[model samples]
Structures are given as structure tokens and as C-alpha cells.
Target: MPFSHAFHPATDHTRLGKLFYDAVEPASFPAHILRYRNNRAAATVGMDTLTDEEWIDHFGRFTPLPGSLPHPLALRYHGHQFRQYNPDLGDGRGFLFAQLRDDKGRLLDLGTKGSGRTPWSRGGDGRLTLKGGVREILAASMLEALGVETSRALSLIETGENLERHDEPSPTRSAVLVRLSHSHIRIGTFQRLAANAETDAIGQLVAYVLETYYPQLGVPAEGEAALTLFKAVCQNVARVGAQWMAAGFVHGVLNTDNIAITGESFDYGPWRFLPRFDQNFTAAYFDQTGLYSYGRQPGALLWNLARLAECLLEFCSHEALTGALSDFPELYETALDAAWCRRLGVMQENPEADRAFRHAVTLFMETSGIPFHCLPFDWYGGGISAQRALASDRAHFYNDPSFSDARKALEARRPLPGLSLDHPYFAGGVPCNMLITTVEDLWTSLNDRNDWQALDRKLAEIDLMADALGTRESLSD
Candidate 1:
């Protein structure tokens, strides 16, 4: 229920497996522990799809995935809280509980973010707030649905403990966020080894990442083989960045420690998906400088990769490392082009068509901003019929003079990249649902005070349209 899709739990995740129930309650990050009722996602992960009674059974329970003991692991090192060399931060509030392959063979980490203190917690309570968990779950699910490559939120439980931070008005409660990631290794994993002059461990970590995450890299485990691993990580990282951009998702925090070697979306702290296109948009309250805004994410990813590349240089030559980074722009553009093509249902690169789609998107945002900017996203998504019909309603756009840009953007014909008569992603496309008014009330509803839930509930009713829309894979090129 807390995740994007449901399946029976595979087996207890076995990687560097550690079990918990006797949490130390680091008491510094005092988490407001909340137990998630995991009937849906837990089952999918091959765990005991819990019954209410079973849920209580699992909590404070640390049974390792079958046939495994506490798997050994060391946190990779790096700078943090901005550029400070904090070589001591590793699973501060949480630990990697288990790692398992999903039915798709994608490895997902069943790690807890606010589980409790680890050796590196720095005298801080490892507790998470209930509110913190809630926000992360929402952010993860919504992003996944929108086709962004992100770590999944398995289950979240409020720890029921109260937390007080300088930012909260009242005491906050913590929640246990069961994070599903491709790998638990972070950039810090590499940095820490580099810091300690443990080149051996650094190589070991690189080998582990390659064997577990990218055996396809076709490189050996030692020597320049490490450079090859770096190249693969760069590709994955760059593709993820493009996904975030094409979908308007902002991770908010891009600390080196959060950069998984697998380049999957790992930490979900202070993240948000922008409802409106604003390059300067930021989700974290403390991110005053907008360091992790929508537009800046790609640069941040590249910056983190640079850090990783530097760390790897201890083993590989700079010439090789620098060469690896060169692959970034091409990889990122390819991902963006693919995503953009999918959205438009076209694959051939047609500059004119792309320009038109971009224009339409720009105009849709301008018009949509006048009303219902955040809630329903029918204009960008929904059925084409509904979307095209709503465009005729001048009242929505006319209210804001700037909204006219949308009209011009749409009217101008540019060869659209995905405008092919048969792109599967848009094969049976229908218009989006922007208004709740009975088929006849689009004009009035545009002017009415936006009622979000009215649209949200209606969405449930319209899911049938998805079936009517037919199989999406059929649109695949």
C-alpha cells in the first residue's frame, strides 16, 4: 500500500544483512517510530505480508533474510552538511536491513532511515518524525507513477516518539521509512575508503558495486577496471538526472553520502515534484540558496559524480577518469530525448515537433497557473480529447494575460518529435481531466475556487479510462 506496486515479498534481503528490533533509540535523532501496516508492499517484497497481529510480530524483530546473518558492511566516507569532511557519517539514523532482487531482478534495499543510531550518528538520536516519513512516502510514490526513476518507499511507521527540532512549532514524531534502493552504497562509501587511505577497501567497494549493480560493465575488478565502473556509475547517474528533469522531480538534497554507486534515487529527504515549471523551485525549507532546485539537479549530479570520480582516481589514472566523465552529456541527452519521445509518442528527432511540444508545455503551465496549479494535472497528462477540449475555454487562460503565451505556443507548428501517427505511449491518448464539472461545466469550473479532492476522487472513477486507453506497452517502439 505504501509503494508503487505490490508483490509478495521475495526473501529476507540478504546483502550486508542486519536485523533490528532492539533499536538503541540513539535518542539524538529521536525518531517518532510509526509501524506501517504492510499488507500490500510487504507482500511484494517477499516478506510476511503482515496481518495486524503479524505487524506487531515484525516490529522490534530483526530476522535476517533467510540463510543470512548480520551481513558485514562499512559506510563509505565523504564530506557532508555542505563541504565539511565528515568522514564519520554512515547510516546515522538507519542501517541497511536487507537487499533483495525484486521479480524484475532489480535489487531493492529494505533499509530504514530513522531506525536508530549507528556508530556514526554523532551522539544524535536516530529517530525520524512522523511528518518526515509521510512526506517522503508521498514524494516517492508520486514520482514513481510519473515515470521518474526513484527508490521506492516500502513501508513507513510512525515511531510514536516525540521529537523537537528548532524548526518545528510543536514536538515532532518520527517514522520508520523502509527505503527501497538499488544499492545501499553511497559516494561516502568510496570517499571514506579514500580518506582512510584504504585503497584496498576502495577497490573492494568498487568491485562489489560492479558485481552487484553493473556486472555488465565488462570490466575486471581491479586496476583500470575501477575506471570502467566509474563510467557505468556515471551513465546510470546521468540517466537518472535526465529522468528527474523530464518529469520535474527535485531531490532537494544531493549530498555525496546520498549518491548511490548504482546511481538510483536513494535518500528521500525534503524532496518534492514541482507542480509548475520553475527552474528555481526548491522543496527543502533550509535550502535557502535554492542549491537543489529543479534546474540545478543535473549540475549537482555531475558535481557529485566529480567527487566520485576524484575518489576513484586513487586507483585509476586521471586520464581514464576524465574520459569517463566525458560520457555524461551524451548519456543525459539520450535519456531526455527518449523520455520526451515517449511522452509525445514519437521517436524520430524532429526539431519542429519538439519545439511545438515545448511550446504547448510552456503554454499549459501559463494557463494552468491561473487556477488549479497544484492539484489536478489534466492538462499535461490526462486524455488528449479532454485536454484539447479544455483548451477552447478561453476563460481559464484569459484571466492571466501571460497565459496567452500558451496559446501562441500551441498554435505555432513545429515538427513535433513524438507527433507520429502511431507512438505507442500515446496510441489511445485521451484528454486530461482538469475540471470536475459534469461534461458540460468546464468553463464555469475554471473560474470556481479550485476544489482538489473533488478532482482526486474523480480520478479514482476515471482509472477505468486507463483500461479503456489499453495496454501502454503496445505503444512501445
Candidate 2:
């Protein structure tokens, strides 16, 4: 069925008071419908709250609210699907309610997913499941609290309809996710228009993104201009991975459609944080190949960025885009190292420190053999951050076997995580964190520690300790 009004911009009238008669409708799902109005969170944005009845009036039955207006314009975008170009993709079942400036001057767009069908539905059902909305809310909130930059969930309302979901139990309830984001332009958006030979549209979207999210890029011609945008993207990609690594998060799916051009974590789906270290861990139960394993996050991100670079082929010379792509490795490596340092609370950046950091990572993974979640993984990955890092990966000042050349490199720093290691808030158990277990396991077969994977686990322990110690220091300071 065609939509009643396609891409109609409406300033959620329920924003001020109850959405009286004919404003909302029952959720459109087959499962349990759960309605979560935008009152409480909306208040934070300095918006008014509506009564329960008003909420129902606005969302329960499909009707325009009092203050609602056709959006001044249809949100414009294009992107790739999988690896294919898709030029005609827009809000198939969603619309931008309004654009507002947050306290920090960040342009925040309030968007509704599953409100109804739009010009972009592409002849498919445009519905959202309650469970899916719940998942995204938890994913975004948890990641943000872990210090990852992410989109925020403003509200999730049940439209009083039962939804059929493919991944969950049959006949799930329906819900709507009204999310706030810095930008929604995605890599797929670029690929879609580019594939249609709509260079002009791609340019318009690129310019919009620059003016909206990365005004600093200034939308110059390809070459250094393209490189600048690419560089910005690479930095964001690297930094996002660093944050993910620090917290042991694994994004189950990282398709071109999922990677946000703005660099903020967007489109939360099947995400998990490791409780124990395991390079082969994944979030999706069906990811049998582990194509997006926990350890391969950095590589996957780089690949996604490369796809984005490919989209810019028309605006910039192939050489320019390639040059920008090249920066990804150097930039990602540095950010990776820096993230380890920050997570460990290391005070300096050096190859030696990074090596020890890698070793620490290796140790934790080999010993625990645990999935991405477990008690030990939670503490350090959570905030057991010690502000101190090793002076260098070469800490063997004393000729002690326990403090061997490798151990020396790892433990050469003084003040140890300096002080955070001693704090209770950051401490989980006295010992046996995933990283510690890995190191101790290595100790049992000390010689076997030479194995790359085994050593990686041990290094993970060192890094975890550093994080704990660093966290303890912050409390002390």
C-alpha cells in the first residue's frame, strides 16, 4: 500500500502537550506493542512533555499533531547496499521530525524510524520491531557511557501494532525509534547516487555533510581537498575503533550501509562487548565465519573507509583518493596505539609501549578462551583504567626471570598505573581478570609463552592492569 503522506515533515506536535484526537495510532506489529513516549528525555532537550493520553493521541493513532508541519523539505540522501550502488534510497518508512541545535551547538536531527512509508520504501514493508528498538537503545547508551561517540536514542514508542520479526520469536510487537544524530548521511548514500551517474547529487550531499558535520573540510575540489575529507574520515574511523577496542566491543555487522560518513557510531545493530579476550569472537550468533571478528575491527573499518574513498572517484583524482586511503594505515596504527595508551592510561606514545600493549592483548586472548563477555573482560574493558603505561616495552632493568626481557619491557614504569590499580571502584576481583588469567596460564608453560597467541593474552593482562591502575589513579587524583 502506498503511504498516506510521503516524506512529510512534522514537528512532533506531542512535543508541547498531548497529541489530541487523530494524531497517533496503534503500533503496527504482530508482537507485543510497547509505547515509550519521548517525554522524559525530551525534557532534557528543553522540550515540553505530553500527558499519557496526549502521547497516545499523537503516536497510538496515525494523525497529525497540532503543531506538526510538513517538513520544510524531504531529507535527501543516497548510498550503497552491500557493494552495489543505490541511487534511489531515502526515508522509506521514516521522516525527520525537526532539526534543533543542542546545547553544544551541534545540529541534532530528530528522526522517526518506522513512522510510516516514504518515497524510498522500494516496495518493501517499512516496519520496526520493539525488540530492535530496545536493542539499539541499550547499545547506544552503553557505548556512549563507555566514552564512545554515538547517536542518542531520544524516544522509543510502541505504536500499538504487532510486528513480525525475522531474528526473534515469531509475532513480535511493534515500536518506533526516534533517534537523535549528528548526521545520517552514510557511505551507501554516496554509492547510491554515484552509481546512478548522479554526480551532481553526490556533490550536493557531500557539501551538505561538510556544512553540517565537518564544516572544517570546506568542500574543496578533489585532490588535497578530497584528501582532507578522507583524512577526517580516516581519523574518525581509527578513533572509533580505538574506542571499540578499549571497551572490547564488536559490531556484528559493518556493511557499507552501516558506516556513517560523519564518523560517529550509527545504526546500532547486534553489538557486544567482550568480557574475556578472544580474537575470534563475534556478536551475531549466525556469523559462523567470524568475518567480523573482534580482533579484525580495525581492518574492517579501514575497508569500509576505502569504499567511501572509492565513491569520491569523480570529485578527486584516483591518485588523490588513493593517497588519502594510504593515510589510513599510518593514521589507524597511531590511533590504535594511542587508544591502547589511553585505555591503559599510559602517559607516553612509543613503539616499545605499543609492542608491550600488543603482547598484553595477545596474552588475554589465549588464556581466557572466553567469549567477548565475562567478568574480567568487563572491569578493564569497562573502566579499570590505570593512568600509567610502561616507560617503554623494554623494562628489564633487573636480571630476574619473572622480569625477563619481555616482562621488563612491560613493567618498566613507576607509580604503576600510578594509582588507579588500588582503587576499589575500578577493581573487579583481586585477580583472575581475563588478561591476568592469560598471563598466569602462560606462566604455567613459561616457554610456551613464545607462541604469538599465548603471548597476546599475557600482554592483554599487562594492559588490563595498566587500565585498572590508571583508573585507580584518577580516583586518587
Candidate whose lDDT is highest:
1
The digit string of per-residue lDDT tens for model 1 on 140-166 reads: 544454455667677665555667877
User: Per-residue alpha-carbon lDDT of model 2 for 1-477, expressed as tens digits?
Assistant: 111222222342223222110222223443323334434335534443455554444443433443344332234455544444456666666665555554445566666677766556787566776656756665665555445667777666665566676776657656778777766667776666666677776566666566667876665665345556667878887887777776677888777767777777877666766656777888778777787788888777888888888778887788877777777777767766665555443444477667566565445444635343332222242222222112212212222243244333334433223344444434444332332243235434422333434433433443455444443224222
In candidate 2, what residue range of length 10 has the lowest lDDT sum?
Answer: 16-25
Q: Give the TM-score of candidate 1.
A: 0.74
TM-score of each: 0.74, 0.69
Clashing residue pairs in all predictions, respectively, total 59, 76
Show where candidate 1 strays beyond 4 Å: 1-40, 71-76, 219-223, 343-477
Whole-model Cα lDDT of every candidate shown, in order = 0.57, 0.56
